[model samples]
Target: MLGTLAAVPVGERPELLAEPVAKAVAGLPGILVAEIDPELADTAAFCEAYASPPEFSANCVVVSGKREGQVRFAACLVLATTRADVNGVVKRRLDVRKASFAPMDLAVELTGMEYGGITPLGLPADWPLLVAPEVAAAEAVVIGSGIRGSKLAVPGALLAGLPGAEVVENLAR
Candidate 1:
């Protein structure tokens, strides 16, 4: 069932879904939720097991930086084929003197989601959601559904339009 995109009441209210993912899917149109095995949570395993194309999978990374003794966070989303421009583009865009990936513990604590399942959908309102232009241009993208037990299939434009989301060029390379 990994690759089969099962039918799980992903209606206006995805009741069977987890809290963080359900909250997000309930609000967004044209989004589907698929329950998956936690053991196959990582992108590579999930994709291979589910027959998903790596091209359609997006990874959400938590980036952090400090300026004036303040730490800031942002969620950078790029396709599996590329990596986020963390030190260069991210640092400059965040306007932080320096930027680096957030610590695993901090990311988990702040997002209130599993370490590998932190999604842009329910991140802090203050944190920016930086989406690569290519990702926004895709028909749909597969992203963590707030937990390792599932993934959210959502339209790229919808993701780009999320409250804190911004389409940025050179986000990934």
Candidate 2:
């Protein structure tokens, strides 16, 4: 659960979300959005400043790899307390020889989100959204809102059900 920061139904704060993220969560249920200092968008800083627990915050990382001269991209969602198994599970899932966090510039450009606020919502339809089981089963979790100035809080089940999302066991460590 989030502390101190006031959270409102996401639908009521479209301005707090990036365009694509706004559209993606437009009619979703049980989603809350809160405004935060852009400077504290990073998970550790945001949690510390907002009095939120690190375990209840989810990090969305953009991963990419090349295979046979083609590039593939995916979004991996893991709890702030864990790290995604990018080179192991993710590389095998994407059928790539290696997987790594995508460059910040490319991630921002492709997701149409700020550098530190790329959430799993509104990723390109073709991009696989791999979610760790821990994140998908949490009662609630805080995640980016596609903008540095805000964050979204939602039930883990909601994230697991997002379009393109695939809950994967041991996706994180």
Candidate 3:
């Protein structure tokens, strides 16, 4: 389903992918990485310019909150068609008080991925990957390649099967 773009096999991913994402997905089957113009990296722009539908685009958001007086983080993935249930579902799932979007600086610093390109693949080891059910079911979804210069097309199963990934119902609203 990803034949629309100029993509390389996952094993041949370029350096544009963050070190962690590249390392994690190396040799993984059913993952394709496509280099894109940084100017069209945002979801809407990328979709329109690349002929990918919104339903097949996954947005990765970083959420943070405090649990037991210590900060906790999670990478929440939801289809572009919906929004992550951050205040309700995500906060409850993370078992934290007052969960909110992570500050851009912190997100970039911690994920080692550029803004607009944070992906669950290379998230902090301790951080959980909260995936929306739809995203986990799509045959193929476009996601960040850890940088604004490229994107990744991955099978839903591959994303849901990532270490610490949890596909939750109603995770998106």
Candidate 4:
């Protein structure tokens, strides 16, 4: 059990996951799912209510920047204790003059996820998924399930291995 949450294999509770998340996790090993109060889905409240530590919770942030005229986007995974460095590392990585968190409406529409519960698992295949070294090396980490009512627990290596995923150093600060 992670904190007081009784996590079980994600496949065992498909109803708890968003449609895209349910599809993304199919056949993915070492993934667990647990239900939670929607109102506590934010990192701080979720951690406090579930007795999970910030270091063990990963936050998925969507960042976007325009180069020339085309907008480029990426999803970054960082431990809750630190925030993604959107202005520095992310900007440089995306090769854009400026980078910022994507607007909530855009993020939700593009990712097909709720505002507070976007996860990297089911993001558009074209978007790069950035995984912080610290997060990618953890034994297991908690992440959103594409909806506020549930969360997913999985080995960090699983995230690193996802398609288009890159392990970035100093991604968080």
TM-score of each: 0.92, 0.99, 0.95, 0.98
lDDT of 3 by residue, 1-173 (tens): 34368887867756868888888887788888898899999999888888888888999999999999999889999998899988899999889978999999999999888999988887888889999989888898999988999999899988999989999999999
Candidate 1: give the clashing pairs: 3-50
Task: Give me the displacement of residue 168 in model 1, in angstroms.
Answer: 0.6
lDDT of 4 by residue, 81-107 (tens): 999999999999999999999999999
Per-residue lDDT for 1-173 in model 2, tens only? Answer: 78789999998889999999998998889999999999999999999999999999999999999999999999999999999999999999999999999999999999999988999988899999999999999998999999999999989999999889999988999
* Candidate 1 per-residue C-alpha lDDT over 58-135 given as tens digits, one digit per residue, 9 for 90 to 100: 999999999888998999999988999999999998889889999999998888788777777878889999999998
| Model 3 weakest lDDT span, ten residues long | 1-10
The number of the candidate with the highest lDDT is 2
Evaluate residue 41 in candidate 3 and report its C-alpha lDDT on the 0 to 100 scale: 91
CA error at residue 11 for candidate 3, angstroms: 2.2
TM-score head-to-head 2 vs 4, winner: 2
- Give the CA lDDT, 0 to 100, for residue 164 in model 4: 96
TM-score of candidate 1 versus the correct structure, residues matched by position: 0.92
Candidate 3 C-alpha error for residue 89, in Å = 0.5
Residue 89's lDDT in candidate 1:
95
Clashing pairs in 3: none
The top-ranked prediction according to TM-score is 2
Candidate 4 differs from the real structure by a C-alpha RMSD in angstroms, to one decimal, of 0.8
